[model samples]
Target: MYRERPAAVITGAVLWASEAGPDAPPTRVLPDGCLDLLWSSRAGLLVAGPDRRAHLSRSAAGERWRGVRLPPGVGPAVFGVPADELRDRRVPLDALWGRAAATLAERLGPSPTATALAAVAADRLAAGGGPDPLAVRVAALLAAGATITATAAEVGLGPRALHRRSQALFGYGPKTLARILRLRRALALAHGGVGLAEVAVRAGYADQAHLTRDVRDLAGVPPTVLLAR
Candidate 1:
């Protein structure tokens, strides 16, 4: 069983919980330009970093998990590290927060709730003075399908400067973020019953084949397989 809701204390953050069924298979978690603070019944507290490709997660049968999903650009402030440093990795919270993480884990106990995780993230984020406005703007522009040049101009940064900042903010350059967001858009459209050809065009792909290739590259599956799930 799984459920999620928007976190009341943090903008664009989600609080989620899940229990792995006895027969559950490894789950494929697609890249979504986010970071997560997670607590597991068996693993204690951990940080789930941004991903450039899909991540396959295996869990013990009946394990319970709770997490606070932080939107792009919001994690660095909360985690006190550049997003790139933790990309494609899941590390124990103690590695980053040391004794503090251990303290938080004790507070969470064995059956941590998503609400508790959200409160912790909110408190840390507030102390960090919040996410960078420029990084947030960059993610918005790219997700909205703006060209990289246009996004940089709107943000008043040069291309090189923008790329450098993006690496720290999003764990990748703007071009990669744009591609991931576009793939997400395409999936949304396809799931809504839109035809593949139209979904490709609407999502900025050149054609259905282009969309298929991008989906396979980033998600490790073709569009048809993803949609079936």
Candidate 2:
């Protein structure tokens, strides 16, 4: 089973995936500039960092996993690590948090479910001073295909300042973020059964060739393969 929902105390979402059959294939997790605190039935708590490309993960049949996905720019504040260091990485929570990780592990107890994991994330966010509204705005603007210069002006940040913040928050510059966001937009449209050419235009790509290149770059596959499952 797989299910997801908006989180109550945070700006992102929570999701859980469990084995459906004995021969279930590994799942492909796409990049979306978010970080996750995951609790696995076999592995306890782990941190799944932001990705620049898709990740393939497998679980034994009947094994369950729960995760709290934090909004971009919010994980560093809660975990006390730079986004750049964690990019494309998954590490044991204890590695980053030591005693705090152990305490949280105990609080989550055995067989931690998604709701319990979300509670732990909520507590951590409260302790870390909560989510930054500006980061949310920056993400929204970028996802909407706004130019970095225009986004900076709207957010009242200079170009250099925005670049620095983007690095810390997204582990990349605005241009890279825009590319990722555009890829996501195109994929969403494709999933909705839109033609590839129309998807490119709607997702702000220059053409179908541009969309295909980006899909291959970020997803490690062409759009057709990615959308086929």
Candidate 3:
């Protein structure tokens, strides 16, 4: 079974999952413009990089895993690496942090649980400094449906400056982040049983067709198919 919840000390969402039995691993993963730090019983510690499209993850049956999903503009600071380098990749934490990753893993001990993982993340963020204020503001404005130009102006940055910062922080520019966030909004509404047409309107899409196109582009599946999963 899979489960997710809002994290208290962490800046973004938390998710944990375990296989019910000897079943095949689930295959679909949609882009959410976020980076995930994952710990698995089999894989140990791995950092799942920001994805621009749906990805397929394979694991053994009955495997268990936990993750901290860091939001846009926050990961680069928390992970201590440029977002650009990690984009569209799943890398072992040891590769990036070397001994530090080993030390953190040692702190986690064997078969680390979600609470332990969160504690490690909290300690790192506390030491590394919190997220950049400008990046946070930019994320909020774009998520709230502001235009790219407007968000840049509000953040007191020019278009190129905003793009550069966004690339460093989000692994993509603001325009792509806006699209991903809108798809996320629509998916949330759909999960809450909202009709597709209303989801499109409320998510700021021009129409249902627009919503469908965006969903397919990002998720590699139609809204109905994606939601059904």
Candidate 4:
């Protein structure tokens, strides 16, 4: 079972929980330009970094998991590291926070709830003085289908400057984040029963083939397979 809700403690963050059944198959987690603070029944506290491609998550049977997913750019503030450093990796919390992570692990006990994870992230983010305003703007513009050049201009940064900042804030250049966000937008439209060709056009793709290639590139599956899930 899986469920998620908007995190009340942090804007644009999500609190989610899942329990794997004995028969559960490996889950494909698509790239969403976000980072997650996770507490696993089997693995304890862990940090799920941003991914450039899909992540195949194989859970132990009956394992329980809870996580607080931080928005892009917001993670670097809470985790106190550049997002690029942790891209495509899932590391133990102690790897980043050291002794502080140990203390937090003890506080979470054997089983942790999504609310607890969200609280910890919220506290740390507040202490770090919150996410960069420019990051927030860039993410918003990209997700809204703005071109990279336009997004950079909107944020008052040149192409090279924006690319450098995006690496630290989102673990990739603006173009990559833009592609990921576009895939998400396309998927949402497809799931809503929109036709594939229309989904491509509406989601800013050249056509259905363009949509398929982008989905396959980032999600490691064709759109049909994803929609079936």
Candidate 5:
């Protein structure tokens, strides 16, 4: 499948993809309950909510999930991106759920995930309660860190432990997650018209050059290119 979102939250990524191929959008939502699971791949999706608290969820293939509640916030704004971006990226389902919950909360209030979250989190916990739980937990704790280890320790896990769990569940490690998070932050900053050098330092990169590389590595283009997109 290919993505074609025009915009995401200026603070986060809002990837776009098509509704075709082995990779397709998950048909989950509500009228009594407003929710949706948009899959970019088996590993990720854009979980959105109509109101209340928002959050993210993740599990293995065929793994069941329970929706989780988050602090009140807005779900990621995905107005415009492109279908092709979904081709190479596989974001963690947990992260997507979180973004969804947060987004919904911001738009609605502190109860967006009340029913849906209560339903799905148990399934997710039961399915993915292996050794990798630590990684998922750590990633969740990384709310505002620029570096990987800071976030890892905050979650009471060492870098190695975080890395191991990330590998098992996310197919990468804490380092990779942190890197992506930083770049996402940078993208958000750039979208807000922040200077590239400022985005770098605020996001924890040493300089604009480093930020450029990180942006290209994950976004397949430079910060300027993404900004244009």
Candidate 6:
């Protein structure tokens, strides 16, 4: 059977592998069928998988681990987003990877230099689309709206124009981005052995089934499947 080899589920908060060093065996984070965001403090960090079905490798102990894989045609990239904004909504992974990502990702690496990546991340975190007046105002309107039209009106743009900006920078539309944020929230709650039911409640879903479906659609696996690993 096709099974994930070498990879071991270390703990609730982080996925770990038991090799002598962090470089014992590499862990390939095959896209977890979700916008999985991870941060690790290890040497030779072999992480290249984008927000989608990403793969990672770490050669430490005599072991190797290939993380869960994603299905076909996953959209968006979701890395380096703020811890607080994780539950924003169903946004595109790639859309979030602009100048903002450059800053946050800098922190993840061992550059040993004072990089501006964090500052960029800070700007986006505090103002998402804000740094830009139009972007910020529009995003704010979207935030207060119950529908897309309301959000557009608040931002002073037509559907087409808003669509372009969202696609260019955020990878997903405002509503979709919102869903990505929601997924992050669900993921955090579901991190440990939290039941799907609880995850749904904590993430503001209708129920466990809803949560499971939501994750499955984005991550390609049911909630149980994700947490089980």
Q: Write the per-residue lDDT of candidate 3 for residues 1-229, one digit (tens) a residue.
A: 7777777777665755555347665577777778878898888999888888889877787777888887777778778987878989999999988999998888788888666676777777778877878778988998898999999999899999999999888888999989988888899999999999999999999999999999999999899888877
Which candidate ranks first by TM-score, i.e. highest? 4
Sum up the clashes in candidate 2. 0
Q: Where in model 2 is the C-alpha error above 4 Å?
A: none
- What does candidate 6's lDDT look like per residue over 10-55, in tens digits? 1111222233343344333333213223222333212223243223
As a TM-score, model 2 comes out at 0.93
- All candidates' lDDT scores? 0.93, 0.83, 0.84, 0.94, 0.44, 0.43
Off by over 4 Å in 4: none
Go through the candidates in order and give the C-alpha RMSD of each one to the true structure: 0.8, 1.7, 1.4, 0.7, 13.7, 11.2
Highest lDDT model number: 4
Residue-level lDDT of model 1, residues 1-229, one tens digit each, is 8899999999989999999999998888999889999998888899998999999999999999999999988999999999999899999999999999988888777788999999999999999888899989999998899999999999999999999999999899999999999998999999899999999999999999999999999999999998997
Give each model a TM-score. 0.98, 0.93, 0.95, 0.99, 0.46, 0.43
Provide the lDDT at 8 for model 3: 74
- lDDT (Cα, tens digit) per residue for candidate 5, span 53-131: 1122233344322233221111111211121222223344445455654554455333332233333333343444322
lDDT of 4 by residue, 58-150 (tens): 999999999999998899999999999999999999999999999988888888899999999999999988889998999999999999989
Clashing residue pairs found in predicted model 2: none
TM-score quality measure for candidate 1: 0.98
* Order of quality (TM-score): 4, 1, 3, 2, 5, 6
Better of 1 and 6 by TM-score: 1
Model 5 poorest 10 in a row by lDDT? 71-80
Model 6: runs farther than 4 Å from truth?
Answer: 1-110, 113-130, 134-146, 189-195, 198-207
- For all candidates, what are the clash counts? 0, 0, 0, 0, 45, 50
